[model samples]
Target: MSQTLDLSSAPAILFLFGLSGSGKSYVGNLIGELTGCYVYHADDDITDEMILALQEKRPFTNEMRDRYFPIITEKILHLRQHHNFLVVTQAVYKQRHREYLCKNIPNMEMIFIDASDAVISQRLTTRNGGITGASALALRRDFEQPDSNIKVILNEGDKSMLVTQLNNYFSSAQPEKD
Candidate 1:
């Protein structure tokens, strides 16, 4: 079965959430390029303390995320005022965090980037930066899967396949005719 994304409303905020190596950043950038939307990597908002914690192989506690989420949401809100469309990439592992973002950014649309364990492992191993090893394991164990109603993009194949999937998903939408 094929998945279709309804872009009729042209969401103000496109939130892409997933595991560390699930291709959220790649897909978000592609979406931004294809749609002329601004891409904001939420990881850029991570505090130095959080970076140190990750560097030490410590998984972030809910309290840590609680302190961090507000920063991201605030920036997103501020950016939305300037840009009509925004593609945001963040590993929103907790359901409550997702809910908080939705409540704070009412026009946001959440899309989950789905990738198998083997694929994620391979990607993380080859990637130069971001979470990996024990931190990645902790994230996988702690991740709270979102509700089934949310849209998903399975990124198990090669980059071309992933791009094809995104292209089909985005190209199916009818562009506004001025």
Candidate 2:
């Protein structure tokens, strides 16, 4: 038996998570375009203080993340009320954080986006702004890899391959005739 992600019956909320420069945002945007769901970048909820800390090469402490999760949860809940389906991008590196979001949201699916260190480095070099270099490395060092149960999408330097994989993973199913 083959597992299929039926876009027609996709969850109310979808989360794309991984390291910075791993292409979570790109994947989330693509999913939104394909499914016509609203896309939300969780970074948008980042406070200026968090931005400064990141800019100063400081990774967020679990306590900080704990406080942060509620804000994101609230935003997601608000967005859920308006959109039938939603795609969200966040570097939910810790399993606890993923669990927190999952507990608060209904019918949500989380997919991990992965890439080689080389690919991440190359992508970071071209990025205009956002977490990069030491900041990114710190996050990677602190990242708690999700357990085997979570789905993984490898994005190794090829946009076409990524697109093909995503397209294959999510397919629209036609309604059955009576």
Candidate 3:
């Protein structure tokens, strides 16, 4: 059977939770194409200074996350006033941060795109200047697995196959038509 996403069934705001290189951006882009929801990448809008810091081999600090959260929050709120969204961010590692978003965004839901540590490590090597294995391990350690309000937990698989599976999942999760 062909899998399809029922946009109406989708939450107004959806956050994809995963470590870096877990295909959040790729899947988000697919969702954007299949659905008209605007997909925003928090890192893409980082300040130049942050970019420079990254160039200097300094990873994003907690202070930077605090700074970006409000900015991205405001942008999401503004855009949400006009459109639905699929926001991709690495912020879900923090419970309090995720709570803030849950409280602020209406009809929001979290989706955890999970994969094994080995898989994440392998995928990292394919990207330019990807996260170090140690960093990935750190994220793994600091990761607070969410317990509630999760719409779905998708496992990492073949990109194309995963997309189709997600499409079907989203479609099937819809409430029945009247």
Candidate 4:
């Protein structure tokens, strides 16, 4: 069944992902602000306690899709009922998780903010000065490059220009297909 949403109330979730400092959070927030959607970043929301619990008790795996994705899915579905859109920034590196979100999120769209590894490394250092190289290494190792369905944007060192392009790309208006 095709689901419909009230554009004035909510659009759909825009899942943003990329390496550290590739502008996922920056663009997610700007898209939410300009698009009138709620922004949800896992780095901002998932508490340390919860992460520890996941690590200590049982590891999260692809098999855990019904388990974890459901929690996220249920929450977003709840918000989708009331908001105009939900913008989520999380590192979903695997094709499977991407598929899970694609299948579950009703009308999901993805944006992969791409930057050269050097550019990301430089930006991350400037943005998160306290982060260790190990952390950046993990990010580099884990981030999966987006496939054809994802919209790609190169940083090229211009924040204002990127923001303007994004404002137009992520219009508050609904898609014609919807």
Q: Candidate 1 lDDT, tens digit per residue, 1-178?
A: 2433344455678799999899899888866665677999999989887888889887888889999999999999999899988889999999999999999897888989999889888888898877876788876877999899988889777556665665554554545769
Predictions: Cα RMSD each: 4.9, 4.9, 3.7, 7.3
Specify the poorest-scoring 10-residue window by lDDT in model 1.
Answer: 1-10
Q: Flag regions of model 3 displaced more than 4 Å.
A: 47-61, 85-91, 129-140, 159-169, 172-178
Question: What's model 1's overall lDDT?
Answer: 0.83
How far residue 73's Cα lies from its native spot in candidate 2, in Å, is 0.6
Q: Give the best candidate by TM-score.
A: 2
Candidate 2 ranges with C-alpha deviation above 4 Å:
1-6, 157-160, 172-178
lDDT of 2 by residue, 21-110 (tens): 999998888666655779999999987778888988988888788888899999999999999889999998889999989988989988
What is the Cα root-mean-square deviation between model 4 and the actual structure? 7.3
Candidate 4, residue 94: how far the Cα is off, in Å: 1.0
List candidate 1 segments past 4 Å from native. Answer: 1-8, 158-178
- In candidate 4, list every pair of residues with a backbone clash: 9-83, 9-84, 10-83, 10-84, 11-84
Error of 2 at 89 (Å): 0.2
| Whole-model lDDT values for every prediction | 0.83, 0.83, 0.66, 0.63
lDDT tens digits, residue span 1-178, model 3 = 2455565556777788777667677677777876666887766676676666555655556676667677777777887787745555543566667777778777877777777767777887776764555555555565677776565545576555765656555664654669
Per-candidate total of colliding backbone pairs: 0, 0, 0, 5
Cα-based TM-score, every candidate: 0.86, 0.87, 0.76, 0.70
